[model samples]
Target: MLRAEWTKIRTLRSTVITLALVFVIAVGLGVVSLTSVRIAFERGLPLVREDFEPVTDAMVSVLYAQLALAAFGVLVICGEYGGGMIRTSLTAVPSRGRFYAAKIAVCASVALVLSYATVFATFLTAHWTLGKYGPSWSSDGAIRVVLGTPLYLTLLCLFALGVGTLLRHTALALTVVLSFVFVLSPLATVVPGLREVAHYLPDQAGSSIVKVGQQADPVIGPWAGLLVLAAWTAVSLIGGYLVLRGRDA
Candidate 1:
C-alpha cells in the first residue's frame, strides 16, 4: 500500500514541479538575501549588530518556499478527489484506514526528504555567499535550525494534508491553509492583545524552532513551540481521520 501511494505521488508532474520550485526558491532566494546582507554590511549600512541573525537571515526563503510545500500537500489527496481517483483508490485498498495511513506516510516521507534537501542546499548557498557571516554546522543553534527546518516543513505538510482530507477540495483546502498561515497568523502578531494568542499559532510556534536567539516576550521555548505545533498537527490529522472514516469515499 505504501509503495502504491509512493508511486502515485512520484508519477504526478505537478509533484516534480512543486518540489523543484521548493529547492530553487529556497536556495536561490537564500543566496540573494545573504549576498545583499553582505553588501550592506560592507557598505557600512549602520545595521544594528545586536539585531544581526545570520542563520535566520540566510534561510529567510523558507517563508516563501513553505507555500509551495503546502500546495504540494494539498495536491496529494485533493488532486485524487478532484479527478475522481479516490473511488478507485478506495476500491483497490478496501480499508480506508490502511489507505489513509499509507497516504500520510508517503506524504510525510517525501516532504521530509525534500525539505531537508532544500534546507541543506540553502545553508550551503548562504555559507558561500556570506562567507564569515554564515553559520557553520557547529555554530551555536545551527544544528537545531538545520534539523528543525525539515521537521517544521514536514509538520506543515501533514497539517495541510489533514486539512485537504477534511475538505476534499483543492481550492478550498489551499485557501484555508494558506490564509491561516500567511494571513491570519501575521495579522495576529501585529494586532494588540492578539499577539499573545498568535504566539501559540501553528506557524508562529513552529517558527521558534528556526530562530537563533531569544524572542521578545516568548510564549514558549523552541522545543515547547515545536510540541505545540505537533499538537496542532495531531488534532488536524485526527479530525481528518474521523471525517474520512465516516464519509463515503
Candidate 2:
C-alpha cells in the first residue's frame, strides 16, 4: 500500500514541479543573502554586532521557501480529493485506514527527502559564501549550522503534511500553516513578552535547530526547540489520523 502511494506521488508532475521549485527558491534565497552580506562587507557598511544571528537569515529563507513545498505536501493528498481521484484511490484500497496510512507514509517520506536536499544545498552554498570572508567553517557552532538546518527543514515539511491531512482543504491548510509560521509568529514579535512565547511556535522552535547562533532571549536550546516542534507535529499528525478515520471521506 505504501509502495502504491509512492508510485502515485512519483508519477505526478505536480510533485516534480513543486520539488524543483523548492530547490530553486531555497538556493536562490541563500545565494542572494550571501551576496548581500558580501556586498555589505565590500562597501564597509558598519557591521553592527547585531544580535540577529546570521543563521536566522538562512532559517527565514528556508521558512519562506517551504511555503510552496508545504503546499505541495498538502496537495499530495488533498489534491486527489479536489480532483475526485481520492474516490478511485479509496475504491482501490477499500479500507480508508490503509489508504490514509499509505498516503501519510508516502507524503512524509517524499517531503523529508526533497526538503532535506534543498536545505542541505542551501547550507553548503551559504557556508561557502560565508567562508570567503572570515568565520572559518571550523568555527564554533559552524558545523551545527551546516548540518542541523536541513534536518529542521525536513521536520517542518512533515509538520505541514500533518496539517494538510488534518484540514484536507488546500487553501485552508496552507493558510493555517503559513499564518502560524510567518504571519502570526511575526506579529507576535510586536508584543514584548510574546516574543518569547513565539519562540515556542512551530517555525520558531524548529528554527533553533538550524544554527548555533544564540538569541539573547531564545525560548530554548537547539535540541530542545526541535523537540518542541517535533512534539507539535506528532500531536497534529496523530490528531489528523484520528480525524481522518472518524470523519466521512
Candidate 3:
C-alpha cells in the first residue's frame, strides 16, 4: 500500500514543482536575508546585537515554504477527490482505514524528505552567506532547530492532509488550512488576551521547536510544543478518517 501510494505521489507533477519551490523559496529568501545582514554590516546600521538570532534568521524562508508544503499536502488528497479517482482508490483498497493510513504515511514521508533537505540547504546557504555571523553545527541548539523544524513541517503536512481528507475540496481545503495557519494563528497572537492562547495553535506551538535562544525562546518547551501540534494532528486525522468512513466515497 505504501509503495502504491508512493508511486502515485512521485508521479504527481505538483510533487516536483512544489518541492522545487520549497527549496528555491527557502534558500533564495534565506540568501536575501543574509544579504540584508551584509548590507547592515557594511553600512554600520547599528543593528541590535542582542536582538539577533542567526538560526532564526537563517530559517526565515521556511515560514513561506511551509505554506507551499501545506498546499502540496492538500493537493495530494484533494487531487484524487477533485478528479474522481478517490472512488476508484477506495474501491481498490476496500478498507478505508488502510487507505487513509497509507495516504497519510506517503504524504508525511515525502514532506519529511523534502522539508529536511530544504531546511538543511537554507541553513547551509545562510551559514555560507553570513559566515561568522551564522550558527554552526556545533552551536548550542542549532542541531535541535535543524532536526526539529523538519519534524514540525512533516506534522503540518499530515495536518493539512487530514483537513484535505475531511473537506474533500481543493479550494475549500486550501482556504481553511492557509487561513487557519497564517491568518487566525497570527491574529490570535496580537489580540491581548488571545496571545497566550495562540501559543498552543498548531503552527504557533510547533514553531517553538525552531526557536534556539533568547531571540525567540517560546513560552512552551521544544518537545512540549511539538506534542501540542501532534495532538492537533491526531484530532484532525481521527476526524478525517471518521468522515471518510461515513462518506460514500
Judged by lDDT, which candidate is best?
3
Task: Summing lDDT over every window of 10 consecutive residues in candidate 2, give the lowest-scoring window.
Answer: 48-57
Q: Lowest-lDDT window of 10 residues in candidate 1?
A: 213-222
TM-score for each of the candidates = 0.95, 0.88, 0.95
Candidate 1 deviant stretches above 4 angstroms: 46-50, 214-217
- lDDT for every model? 0.86, 0.74, 0.87
| lDDT by residue for model 2 (1-249), tens | 888888777788887787788888888887887777777777888763455455555545676687777777777877776777877887788787778777777777777777778766776677677656534456556667656666676677777778877888878888998898779889987888798788889877877776555553355888887788889888877877787777766
- Per-residue CA lDDT of candidate 3, range 1-249, in tens? 899899877788976687778888999888887888967877789873666788877787897899889988888889899889898998899999999999998898889999899989988898889887777898778899999999999998899899998999999999998997779998998899999999899998888888777856458888899999999999989989999999997
TM-score of 1: 0.95
lDDT of 1 by residue, 1-249 (tens): 999989888898987798788988998888777787888777878653666777776678987899899899899899899889999999999888899899999999999999999998888888889888777887678888888878989998899899999999999999999998879998998999998999899888887888876432266777788888899899988888899899997
